[model samples]
Target: MTAGNRCRRNVLALTVPIVAVVVVVFGFALDRWVIDSGIEIAPEPAALFPSAPIMDPARQSDLDGAHFDALFAQGIAGLRAGKPGQAAAAFEAARRLGPKVPALYVNLGFARLALGQVDAAVESFETSINLRPAQANAYFGLAEAREQQGDMEAALGAMRTFVHLASEDDRFRRRALSAIWEWEAALGRRPSNGTDAAQTETNEYAQAKGSDLLTAELGRLDGGSGTLAHFRGKTLVLNVWATWCAPCRVELPSLQRLSEKLNPEQYAVVGLSTDEDPDFVREFLREVGVAYPNYLDPGRDVAFGILKIESYPQTLLIRPDGSIAQRIVGARAWDEPEMVANIESVR
Candidate 1:
């Protein structure tokens, strides 16, 4: 072939490949935008309770929308008035009118709990969770029911899962985490490993789905000073721990080491204790020696409000932007390379 012909053929080959690539990219983008569908499962509820039995929700024809709305509103009013039985009846009537709606199941669960129908509440919450596992509130309800039945382990597990599923809101997350920690301590099975494998899974899911962490704020412990805003512009590593927690005892040293290693220009670590007794916290700190600033949260004021911290030794890696970067539900090897890498990624 002539040299000019050879050059033209080469240009054509490159152009064809580029065109094919563009077409493929465009197709994928279009599919992504068009194929997005309505979510079937509502995000897990912030509350969870154990499974139980109660009267079935009533079934009504689809045409009864107005009736359903009225019943649902009345049910909510009943719930607000601390009449779970009345609320359940209202929600059941609404459900009978609109059998497909899952929020009514959640409402029913709340009403059942108020009536002390532990098993029934669990069933309602589970139905809600199954219908919408992403709903943190359902999970929270299920956990609450389990707690009522004295099923500490399951309740604790569900509570942890709640926070893991919803840690973006400082309020709910703090409350959930504190509840989890409190229960775990109460059961004497606090996990201190701070395992990254499980945490990585949760973080990936939250990031991909844009789920919020629990962000409710508990009241201040003993009127402790400083809001979470005080830690703004700095990476805050907050650990919710208790003196009696085995895992807390195991993880304290590593946390101290990590705090010491952090450059104050970027990071800070604080340990909030739920020891119930400030003296226990003070004595433990004095004996074992925590280098980071430690505060007492015996009543879980901070744990309940800002982070919804559910369990002891729960570590939160808060970014300078004041958002949670990583949340380790149990104790962790703070000095591990992977932990440092993950924390740094958010930084």
Candidate 2:
């Protein structure tokens, strides 16, 4: 071919390919854009965060106080709905968005406490109180945690603060007073009689008097071959629980670890699950990574009465002869050195 013809042919070849490629790319882009436009974008993960500070349906559109108020209210609603884990997640997100709001931390603490993250709840409440000294709910939450840990004095102190700060909230005020009086009377009676003291310790009060657990023979689940009588002549850690109780869930793993570490010759750990639904209890155990042998309480309240358990997550340290050595209730950081010492002391 001549030079001009050759040049023209080469330009056509390059231009034609370039134009085809651009048209193809544009068509693909258009198709993607159309599809994306029809699809709704998913909500932000943290968009569900509580915003109670500035909450007013009429005013939520504004970035002002009403928006955050709505978030906070949403979190509170979550709590009322029995969705504590969701409430906590909401409160935590709200806290990040509005760092100065002490109420968010207090709410977060409540949610965490309900979820059995006791230490985290304590920390959140402490932070709330530090930020706003007048936040009475935080103090109440701290008191709850202290009570769970069996620290009557500290629990009382926290309750007193709650009463002092939230006198305006009549409900809280009445509750705090009742708790204080009950704890005081219980404390007075704890040290006087060993048996009564042991009973007191069955709930959270057992942390105070340092009492022992009484070994009571009880019926077995599924009509098992063994009986409470079989556990005789052995030191035992008997923990009462229910799948529905969050604190019970947290205490389960700790009890398991305690059991695995101790020699049966020296000590035994027994789990009594108070779930009326055996299947639910078994499923919960499997889901929660618990390996401890669990006995079902046919008449849940019967076991409670026999164990003198005043609360969920009640743990008893029993002597070889089936007498109580110590009783504790609620979720405690069992791995703590002090708790370890307490458990070891009974042996």
Candidate 3:
């Protein structure tokens, strides 16, 4: 999907408005339309300031598009009415329905920004980028979040990417360029390895795929037999976990939610538990209402021996053709937009 961006102005363009918005999602109303995606940005070294303005390049393609959802509209309405809390909730509810629009996360970021939730705003913007890396406006919001965290290099790099990807005719292109220039002057370079932020983002979570293994028979929690071969035609989200691992327990519900959100015909999320006690696993699943098919490996042969998995709560993304695509070694918000889209994007 082609991503779109919308921002009434840049962060440093107006000191009063930008600061107000970041502190509180901006004004109760800015002129006529809602400053739907405003953030508090400070240009000075003392604070995280907005550099310049970058307007929305694809206004029509946002939540108001042809495939509109009521929740998405409600979120926009909340933003427009100066009620960011309501706006944030609406956006998340809309996310559960799995709307693929990148702007959705953009608006959610603004709402979080207004609430003074800098970390969450950063997550939303990054997720938007994950959905569509070319979405120029997401960079605008991200620059602010990175600045707030005192990551000047990352912030500068995000603006640079925005400028590179944004169309020349984009009304706010000049303003964004101005921000970049100011950031570079202040930092004394084009972001001393700022691009590494994006690189490390992927590097931390993404692992290289390897060859398919044993395809061996395994014990199902229901007493029937199973194997990786049964899911050959679908992308398998193989989560290696155990009932005893606390992080695994924390990650399972969201993984189950991820399983539910994905198209069952094309994707399957299965649990590979290494618990010696099948009844304990059964009790854990039943207690959590986890209905996904799970296979047991008491001896750890299939896990440690075959997959070479050395950690608990590990996840592997298996392609439909029986090859591994990606692996994650820790807990994650499996149901988040980035993770869901990552799963669906598997070839």
- How well is each residue in 1-347 modelled by candidate 3, as lDDT tens digits? 22322233443467787577676644445533565556656565664345866565663323343234688889999999999999999998887665566778998998998888999999999999987665677898898788788898898888767665543345665676666667766777544655534334333322321234426557787766667786888999999998768899999999889888989999999999987556768988989989888898754656764577889889988888877789899999999998898888998
Give residue 118's error in model 3 in angstroms: 65
> How well is each residue in 253-280 modelled by candidate 2, as lDDT tens digits?
7776777777767777788876544566
Worst 10 residues of 1 by lDDT: 211-220
lDDT of 2 at 211: 37
Which of 1 and 3 is the better model by lDDT? 3
Model 2, C-alpha of 309: deviation from truth (Å): 44
- Indicate whether candidate 2 or candidate 3 has the larger lDDT: 3
Clashes of each: 91, 30, 14
lDDT of each: 0.73, 0.71, 0.76
Best by lDDT: 3
Backbone clashes in candidate 2 total 30
Q: What's each prediction's TM-score?
A: 0.40, 0.38, 0.39
Task: Give the per-residue lDDT of model 1 (tens digit) for 254-326.
Answer: 8888877767777788777765445556667878878677766443535654566777779888777767777
Candidate scoring better on TM-score of 1 and 2: 1
- Using TM-score as the measure, name the better of candidate 1 and candidate 3: 1
Give lDDT: candidate 2, residue 323.
75
